[model samples]
Target: MIALLSALLQGCALPSLEGRSESHALKRAETADTALGRALMPQAQARPGLSGILPLADARDAFAARVLLVRAAERTLDVQYYIWREDITGNLLLDALSEAAERGVRVRLLLDDNGVSMDAKLLALDRHPAIEVRLFNPFSVRRPKALGYLTHFSRANRRMHNKALIADGQAAIMGGRNVGDEYFGATDGVLFADLDVLATGAVLPELSADFDRYWASASAYPIDRIVAPEGTAPAPVPHAEDDPRAARYLQALRESRFVADLLAGGHLPQWARVDMVSDDPRKGLGLAEKEDLLTHQLQQVLARPPVASLDLVSPYFVPTAAGVDVFSRLAARGVRVRILTNALEATDVSAVHSGYARYRKDLLRAGVELHEMRRGAQPQGGGAGVFGSSGSSLHAKTFAIDGQRVFVGSMNFDPRSAHLNTELGFIIDSPVLAQAVTQAFDRDIPASAYEVKLDEGGGLVWTERRDGQTLRHKREPGSTLVRSVWIGLLSVLPIEWLL
Candidate 1:
C-alpha cells in the first residue's frame, strides 16, 4: 500500500525548470552610485583587501539592520533563508521588500521549500514585477506536504540551510537567523539565542556570488512554477505601533545605532581577513563532491588544532561518535574543549537532544566539558548578549578556537549539518571577536547555563549557580521524569545520522 501511494505521488512530480531565466547578482560597479554603495565605498577603499565585520548579537538590531538595508537599497536585494515565518516581523520585512520593489529595486527572495508554506501572500509577492520568489527543492503536493517526504525521501531529506541578506551588492548580513517573531524576540514563547554579522567590503562580492549560485541552481523553482496564482496580496500588517508586542521592537529600532553608525562610518567594524564557507548548492540534489561540502572547507580553514581552548555553541548538538572521538583526542592533548547546547527543558527539539544525550557519558569520560543552557535564564545586556531572553533556547551556531579564530553561521555541530543540509558561515581571523566569544564562555555562559559533570560514583550531575550559591541536580535540570524516560528510549534508537 505504501509503495502504491509513493508511486501515485511520484506520478505528479514537480514542474520542469527548462526555461527558467537565469539571473546574476548586480556587480559592485553597477551599484556604486546607489546610496548604500556610495556610503560604503569610502570604508571599502580604506580597508582595501580586508572585510569589515559588525556583530549583530542583539535581536532587535539584527532585524533592524535587514529592514533598514531594504529601505536603503536602490539597485538590488538578494535574500535567502532556510525559514521565513509569517509573523509580525516576517510580514513587516515582506512589506519592506514590497516597498523596495515599488521604488524599482529588483528583489530576489530564495527560500527553502521545506521551511515555508506556499500561500496566497507569497504568490502575491511573486506577482510583483520587481520581485521574484523561488523555492529550493519544493514539494509537488502542496497540501499534505509531508507526503513529498514519503514519496521522495532521498530528495526531500536534503535541504538548503543557508541564510543571507545582501543589499546593493555592497553589504551583506549572514549568519544563523531566520525571519520570525521568535528569532527577533517579539514572541513570549521560546526565543532563540542567535547570532549574525553585518559584513561589507571584500566579503560582499563573494557573498553575493554565492547567492547567485543558489539562485540559479537546478533545485531552485520559481514560486509561480510550483504554486498557481491565488488571491491578491493581502493588506500589509499594521505598523508596529498597532501591535503591543511589536511596539517594543519599534522602540528598539529607534534606539539602535547600527544603521546610522554604519552610514556615518562610526560603526567601527572590525577589519579582518574573513572567508565565507558554504556547501555547494548542488548538495541539495545529492550531487556535490565531498570536497565541495562546507565540512571539508571548515576542516581546511581550522586545520591547526587548538593549543589552548575551544568554545563551541550549537542548539542542536548531536555530536556523533566520530565527533566525540575528535573532541576526546583534543581534550587528551591538553586542549580545553567546552561545549554549550540546549538543555532538555530549553530545547525545542527533544529528539535531537536524545542524540546528544546518548553520547554525554563518553564526552565526560574523555574530559570534555559540557554546558546546557537553562530555560528562563536571563542573559546579560537585557537579553541582547550572546545568550537570549528570560525564557529561551540556545539556537546560535558558533565557536571560537584558542581565542584567535571565530566561526559564525548556520552550520551546527551535528550529523544533519555535516551530511544532509547545505550550510553557510564565515571563518574570521579576528582575535577580538574570537575572544569575545571565549570571554562569554568564561563569564556569561556559567551564569546562564548548567555545567554537566560526573559525580564521585561516575554518575552524571548538573551544577547550577544561583543567588550566590551553588545548587546540584542528580538528573537533567528542569526536565520531567517522563520526558527523561522518553529521551532515554529515543537515545537507544540508531538514528543519530538523521539528527
Candidate 2:
C-alpha cells in the first residue's frame, strides 16, 4: 500500500499531443480592422493605453461587457480561463461565441482541465468550423474525479489560472474574474467583488504572444482528441437558438448604465500607458520558481527601490512566513501597507481563512493595516447593480503602488499563486488607473469591511459602521461557537502552504 501510494503521488508527464494543425490568431501578422481594432490600433501603435473598468463590481455590467465585446469583434476572439460553468452566464457566453464563429469569425478557447464538467458543451463548441478548444494539462481519466487526482496529483494540481479575453489582437480584457454565475453576479446567494481592465495597443502583442506560447506547449491538448475518445459525445456545433433567459438578460444588459452610456456614443476612447507582465510558459509546470514567476517580476519592479505605499486586495490571503517577512520589511521602510481580504463568514474557503487568521497579529505588529470584508448583504430588490445583487466577497487580486501603478490579475498573494499555478496580468504605469483602483479601495474598505486593530492586550478587535451605527465585535463577527471551534481546529493543521 505504501509503495502504491508513493507511485500515485509521483509527478507524471503531461499527455502526449496528437497531430493537430497549428491555428494562430485570426489576424496573426497583420492588424485587426474590426470596430475594436479600428478604434484602438492606431493609438496602440503609438503606445499602450488601459481603461480601468469598475462597473464589473456590479455583476450585470460584468457579463454585459463581455457580451458587447463579443458582439463587436469582427475578426477574432481568444479566451483563456480556469473555470467556465454551464449556467446562465457560461451558457450565454458559449452561445455568443458559437454565433460569432458562425459569422466567419475565428475563435480560440483554452481552459484548465481540473474540475471541468462541461464536456458536452465544450466538446460541441470544439467541433465548430471556426472554433477550436484546448485543455491545459488535462487528466487521462475523464471522470471519477478522485481516481484521476490520486493517479496524477502532482501534475493535476498545477493549473493555468490565467484569465483573459482578447479580440482581434488589438484589445483585450484581463483580470481575475472567471466565467461563472457567481463571478458575474448571476448567482443568487453571493456576488464576488472582482476587477478587470480593458486594454488596447502595446500590451496586446505581448498578451497574444503569451497566449500562443501556452497554446502550443505540450501541456495543452486538443479538447476533441482527449474528451471525445472517452465515450463522450462530440457533435458538430449547430446554430444557437435564442434562450429566453438570455434574451431577457440581453435586454437588461443593453439597459445597464455602463452599456447604455457606451451606446450613447459620445464618450471618447479611454486608454493608458501600460506594460504587460507575466510568467514564462515553463512556469505552468512548476519547474521554474521566482526567476520566472510573475511574483518575481513584481518584486523586481518594486525593488527599484519600492513605492511609497501599497494597497492589496485578495480574496484568499495566507501570506506565508516569507510573505510576512516581505511585508514587514516594506512596513519598516515606511511603506504604508493596507490589505483587504474576506472575513471568516464571508470567505468561500474556510481553510484559507484559517491560514490567514494566524497572520493577523503579525501584520498588525508590522504596522500593516488589516481589513476584512463582511458577510454579504441581502440582495436589495434582487438588485443587479455594481456592488452585486446579493452579499459581497473580494475576488479581485489587485495591488496599487503609491497611487501610480495598478495590477489586476489571477495571481493571489498566497503560496499557491507564488509556487504552484501559472498566472497572467499587466502592470500599468498610469496615475489615472492607479487612482481609480485606490479610490475603489478607499471607498469599499470603510463601507463593507471590518478594520482590525490589536487591542492593548494583544487580542484582535474588529470595528465597522453599518446603518448609521458603529458595530464592534470582540470575537470574529458572525462566528458561532461551533464555527469558532472549527476555525481553531483548522488553524493547528499543517496545511498552511496549500492555502
Among all candidates shown, the one with the greatest lDDT: 1
lDDT by residue for model 2 (1-499), tens:
9987776545333445767768776452365557776666665556424442332456676677788788787878889999887777888888889889988888999998873677777888887889899998887656665565667666677888999898888767788889887787665667787777666666677788889888887778888767654354555433223556666666776666887676565434445656666777676666765677788788776666445888888889989888799899999999988988898878999888888998899989999999888887432244432234445677878888898877778889888887778889877777766766576556646767789998989999999877768888888887899988898899999987676
TM-score of each: 0.95, 0.90
RMSD score of candidate 2 (Å):
3.4
lDDT value, candidate 2, whole model = 0.75
Task: Write down the worst ten-residue block by lDDT for model 2.
Answer: 378-387
Candidate 1 Cα misplacement greater than 4 A, ranges? 1-7, 231-248, 257-264, 380-383, 388-391
Clashing pairs in 2: 49-272, 50-272, 57-386, 58-386, 376-391, 377-391
Model 2 ranges off by over 4 Å: 1-15, 26-29, 46-56, 229-244, 263-270, 305-307, 377-391
- Per-residue lDDT for 347 in model 1? 92
The count of backbone overlaps in candidate 1 is: 1
Candidate 1: residue pairs that collide: 376-390
Kindly list the per-residue Cα lDDT of model 1 for residues 1-499, writing each as its tens digit: 9898768776659888999978899899889999888888788988888898999887777898898889999999999999998777887888899899999999999999888863667777887899999999998888888888877888899999999999999988999999998888777786888899989899888999999999999999998898875546552334434666566677767877866876676767899999889999999989999999999998898889899999999999999889999999999999999999999889999999999998999999999999999987776554456543444788889999999989999999999999899999999999999998998888888888899999999899999977778899997776788988898899998888889
RMSD of each: 2.1, 3.4
